[model samples]
Target: TQLLEQSPQFLSIQEGENLTVYCNSSSVFSSLQWYRQEPGEGPVLLVTVVTGGEVKKLKRLTFQFGDARKDSSLHITAAQPGDTGLYLCAGARDKLVFGAGTILRVKS
Candidate 1:
């Protein structure tokens, strides 16, 4: 089984601030995906990185995959209160293994 280690389990920041979250693993993966989830709702996929060193951007957010395919990072610029939620990274081999996730609270 693949295991993912996510850093800064919880983060609280003021609006318009920037923050970065990370997901790491010792095992390699075929693909990595990032998601955002709000209370009482299922996760919403933000981006999928299938190749090593891949980087994707969505509005104020940027997602990057490590060259080794064992790690990933999410950077959010000018964060807003609406961006507050759970951020998750899932790595896939034959199946998907998810990180414990980071909880972000962007206070206005």
Candidate 2:
């Protein structure tokens, strides 16, 4: 069976604060994807890394794929109130398995 588990299902941080979210799994994956979702809106793709040990960045957000493709992480250097939303990580094999999600609230 394949499964993706994300830690810290919820997080609340003050504006301009930093935070990190972790996604882990026992199964190997060819690629991994990250997405952010807002209320009443569909998830938007943040990044996708296919190679092991690959890393990508978007503005203040940093994403890393595990050396074995079994895990991933997202680090936000300075979160803002506009960043408040649900963050999701997915492991891609033959199918995409999504983690429950991490609800982040960046308070003013």
Candidate 3:
């Protein structure tokens, strides 16, 4: 079974807005990764959170890991059209378990 779950299967937002996406799981992961995929391509790794209570920032994007390492969140500041894509969260244990993903569309 998939160990990870992502919320907001679909999201539509305008430029300059802020939004947050969540990823949850019942099982603890050794590490968690966030990825963004565009049309006709594979997912590109955005960030990885290993330690509990870890927070990572990539430009306007902020990622946080729960204290238990079983959940995570991604926050985007000033949404942009370039940020439109499928956002995926993956948890690594014996293998990489990916959530269904959140499809985000940012319109200008």
Candidate 4:
């Protein structure tokens, strides 16, 4: 099985909606990095929660790492079209193991 699995795969929302994406795994990682990507562009680091149970917030988004370092989550509040992008959760050790990803679309 894949090390990481993200749910929904895709999400669509209006200008002012809330959404959450999940990342689950059976294996533990040293660290987890959440990235957001635009078309034809490299993934940009949104946050890296190293310590388990760590919670970091960026604008309308919140990220959390599981206590066992085996999973993570991303929550977005009051979404806007500007929030539209592909959200990817990747677990890393010597290398990164990525989830399929959750593509979010926020329409005005």
Candidate 5:
């Protein structure tokens, strides 16, 4: 079975701080997506990277896909308290494989 591994399993920071999270896999994927989930809520898709080396940004958040399609990263700039949540990465091939997830807590 393929698996996605996320680094820094948990993160805590004061508001306006910056942080970065990573997701990696040994298996190649046709596409990869990032999502964020709050307590008691389903994950909300943040971005999808299909082409190798692709990068996308939403507000203060940035998403990147590795050139080999086996890794990805998410960077948050000046993180705010509202950014606290569980971040997940999913790889799509024959099926979607999800990472363990990174729990982020931003204090105000």
Candidate 6:
């Protein structure tokens, strides 16, 4: 079985702060995905990277996949209070392997 490891289990930041979350695995995946979950809601897919070294940006958020396809990162620029939530990374091959997730709390 493959496993994904996420760093900084929790993050607390003020509005306008920038932060980065990471996900790593010893196994290479065919694809990697990032998701965000709010209270009482299922995780919403944020981005997917299928190619090694791919970088994608969504509004204030940026997603990157490692050249080896074994790691990924999510960076939020000038985070707002509304960005507070749980961030997750999932690696997919025949199945999806998930990271423990990073909980972010952005305060005003």
Residue 41 in candidate 3, Cα distance off native in Å:
0.4
Encode model 1's per-residue lDDT on 13-103: one tens digit a residue: 9999999999999999999999999999999998999999999999999999999999999999999999999999999999999999999
Clashing residue pairs in candidate 6 (N, C-alpha, C atoms within 3 angstroms)? none
* Per-residue lDDT over 31-104 for candidate 5, one digit per residue giving the tens place of the 0 to 100 score: 99999999999999999999999999999999999999999999999999999999999999999999999999
Q: Clashes in model 3: which pairs? A: none
Clashes of 1: 0
**Local accuracy by lDDT, each model:** 0.95, 0.92, 0.96, 0.93, 0.95, 0.96
Model 2 C-alpha lDDT per residue in residues 1-108, reported as the tens digit of each score: 328889789999899889999999999998999999999999999999899999999999999999999999999998989989999998888888899999999999
Candidate 6 Cα outliers beyond 4 Å, as residue runs: none
TM-scores for all candidates: the values are 0.97, 0.96, 0.97, 0.96, 0.97, 0.97
lDDT of 1: 0.95
Q: List candidate 1 segments past 4 Å from native.
A: none
The segments of candidate 3 whose C-alpha lies over 4 angstroms from its true place after superposition are none
List candidate 2 segments past 4 Å from native. Answer: none
Candidate with more favorable, higher TM-score: 1 or 3: 3
The clash count for each model shown is 0, 0, 0, 0, 0, 0
What is candidate 2's TM-score against the reference?
Answer: 0.96
Q: Could you give candidate 4's per-residue lDDT for residues 43-71 as a string of tens digits?
A: 99999999999999998899999999999
Least lDDT summed over 10 consecutive residues: which range in candidate 3?
1-10
RMSD of 1: 1.3
Q: What lDDT score goes with residue 83 in model 3?
A: 97
Q: Higher TM-score: candidate 2 or 4?
A: 2
